[model samples]
Target: MKLLILDLDETLIHATDCYLDRDPDFEVGPYAVYKRPGLDLFLSKVRSQFHLAVWTSSTRLYAAPVVENIFPHDVDLKFVWSRERCTMRFDPEHHDYEWAKNLDKLKRRGYKLEHVLMLDDTPAKLARHYGNLVRVKPFLGNLADRELFQLSDYLPTLAETPNVRRIEKRFWRKASTSEP
Candidate 1:
């Protein structure tokens, strides 16, 4: 199955410069609002063809509000996941090793690596893990950025190409062989 995995912070929601009033009593991930142009159209198109899921580093308590604001009520909430599934690191200098946790989740769910498409701004997270991810730079602009535009450009091509199916099969084949 085709799965679309998205990052929440910079990918879906653009953070404002102001600091959110943190509830000292309640410590959680930072609160941020989203900004994007034609986001509704983009989301609608995505919902049409793909099984949508969120693979964000944000904690569930923090990510839930933002997701509800962005997605329609009818969208399945079961697909939303949080940092609990992410990889964590203690080294201060090392970047958070959290993004690829969703990849594991997807694999456990029987999704082939190629059939899974991750849209993330940070290449560092995906560079070492999955090859099928479409890396996009973070943008706070009013319109869809170049990476998203490129994805749009490729959708039609992907739809018409039989090679994509072959690629998915190959990925599954490799996965089965690797399994004990």
Candidate 2:
């Protein structure tokens, strides 16, 4: 099965220290964590088609509890990696250090880059492997957001592609729909 690495913060859920107008689905320490709409259905539908894992830049202290609450107990993730697992790089454009999730790290663990897909909101974090990335719009506690619902329909289409990297996924939203 292909490995699908999911991002945590704005990609899947929005964790804010300040409360939004609506109550959060769950809380993580002082953060009000809101699950992206259709998150549960997305996970459920994709679980059988792909091997799932989480690769968040957040610390284990923050990521663990959030993962525990969001993912169902029956759905076993291949791994839940935290900040320590990310590669730190100095971004000259931003003039600051950023954590990047390198797919080479997965190659070291016996996974093929062609069989891996990363779902993340930040393109810069996966700049080294744009081929493997399926970018999503950042979710910010929008009650009516529907990205995940659309994503659930799009992802399975790539499940059997010989090399997922070869497919143009930057416009996956459009590719998934009949829209031009």
Candidate 3:
């Protein structure tokens, strides 16, 4: 199976330590995270198709509960990674984050360079690995969101593709083409 590395916080779930509501789907210390709609079904379909792993930018302490709540016990996820496993670079322009997910780290772990795909919302996170990154629109507490299924619809064909490197980024997101 091809490798599919996922990102949290606005990708799989919406989380914020800055806000609090009466009730939340998940409570991770001071952070409140909500499940993205269709996440379960999306994971179900993808689990069968890819060697699934979560590589969120969030720290282990914060991302742990969120992962458990969203993925639960039945999800056959292969691995869960956090900021510790990622590489950090200082961006003078953006002071918010100290690091970005380094896809090369996984490449070194024997995941084929041409056979891996990273589903992330922020472009900067995948800046060094642009070609292999599929830009999924960030999800933020949208229970009606269908982004997961939209991706699921495209994955079967993606899994069947013999050369992942040849697959253009257009097929990765919202662009469409009409050609015979």
Candidate 4:
């Protein structure tokens, strides 16, 4: 199955600035904007073809409200994994665990690093790790760009890629052996 993991925050939704003020009635930030031109349709199309999941660094408490507000009720909420499930990495300077643990859950699921497509705005987290990541700049104010949905446009190319298939096979084999 094709798995598509999406990040929140600057990826799917754009906060006006870096910080988001909490408001129960507001779906987005005070100055935040929703780029809705084709996003809902795009998501619907992809959902028909692949298994979808939300793998954000935001805590479940914080992320749940945003996703609930952004997506329609008909959309399945099965694969919503969050920061608590992520593997934390120590940041010596900050004395905190940087949010990098999400990948570990995917790895544990036996997904080949390549069979998975991660759409994240954080280049620093994705750049050196997986081969299947499609990094996007943090959403400034636009989601209508053709480039933002490049993965959907290039699904055929992604499916036909040999290296990705090989990785998937290897991961599956490893999973089979490790199964109890």
Candidate 5:
């Protein structure tokens, strides 16, 4: 099976630090995390096709709860890694890239390097593994965004291919001319 790495904030859910105010989707006490529309369905679909895992720059203290909220008990996720698991590096050449999710580290952890794919809102985070990346649009609590659903439509194509890197998505090709 292929390994699919997922980002936390903005990729799957939107979070805010406001207390006593709840987002329309869900609330997590002092913080409010909005679940992207069609998230549950999308998760179920991908879980069947790949060995899913959550890898994020957020701390476990915050990320774990948000993950539990959306992923739920029924959704079977392979693993969850927080900021501590990330390689904290700063490239002297690029100043903005503070935290990059290095899939090279994941390779050492037993996930097949070539068979791994990552879905992340931040392109910088996937710079080291661009070949395996599906650059997801940042979901900033927008209820109208259809990226998740659009991604669901594209996933079956990836699932059909034995190696994710070998996928030449017609959806991506078609989207470049119109939408993504």
Candidate 6:
């Protein structure tokens, strides 16, 4: 199966120290975490078509419990990598530092780049591997958000593509809606 790596934070759930207007789905330390709408259904549907994993810029301490609460126990993650796995790079455009997930690490683990896809809200985090990315708008505790629902419908379409990197994904939302 093709590997589908997901991001945490704004990509799947919105975690903040301050409370939002509504109660959070779960609490992790000082953070109140809100699961993105349709997260459960998204994971369930995508699990069958891809080898799922998580790659987050947050510490393992923060990412673990959030992942536990949001993900179903039946869906086994191939790997759950934390910030320690990311490389610190100085972003020339943004004129600051950022933690970038280098997909080469997966390549070292014997996974081919062509068969891997990463879903993240921050394109900067995956700057070195944009071709493998399917960027989503950042989720920020919006109860009515439906990005995951649209994503679940879009992702399965790539399950059979031999080289996912060859596909242009910047306009994924439009592509998803236009599909027959």
Q: Highest TM-score: give the candidate number.
A: 6
Write one digit per residue (lDDT tens) for candidate 5, span 1-180: 788888989999888775223435666666778888789988988888888889999889988888878885876777898888777677556775467787888777777777888888886776666778888878887778888887877765665566776665424535442253
- In model 3, the runs with Cα more than 4 Å from the true position are 18-22, 92-98, 171-180
Q: Worst ten-residue run, lDDT, model 1?
A: 169-178
lDDT winner: 6
TM-score of each: 0.69, 0.96, 0.85, 0.68, 0.85, 0.97
Q: Using TM-score as the measure, what is the rank order of every candidate, best first?
A: 6, 2, 5, 3, 1, 4
> Residue 147's C-alpha lDDT in candidate 1?
39
lDDT of each: 0.58, 0.92, 0.76, 0.60, 0.77, 0.93
All candidates: CA RMSD in angstroms?
9.5, 1.2, 3.3, 9.5, 3.1, 1.5
Residue pairs with backbone overlap in model 1: none
Q: After superposition, how far is residue 81 of candidate 6 from its true place, in Å?
A: 0.2
Q: Choose 2 or 4, whichever is better by TM-score.
A: 2
Which portions of model 5 miss their true places by more than 4 Å?
19-22, 91-94, 168-180
lDDT of 4: 0.60
Please state the error at residue 60 of candidate 5 in Å.
Answer: 0.4
Q: How well is each residue in 115-178 modelled by candidate 1, as lDDT tens digits?
A: 6667777655554454655555576643435334344444433433333434442123222322
lDDT of 2 by residue, 1-180 (tens): 999999999999999999999899999889999999999989999999999999999999999999999899998899999999989987777888889888899998999999999999988788589999999999998878888988888999999999999999987888776334
Q: Give the lowest summed-lDDT range of ten residues in model 2.
A: 171-180
Q: What is the Cα-based lDDT of residue 91 in candidate 4?
A: 57
The sequence of per-residue lDDT tens digits that candidate 4 reaches over residues 1-180 is: 567777877777664544333322244434444543355665776776666788887778767777787677787754887887766676565666677734545677787666677767764455345565666557655434543444455443445454552443213222232222
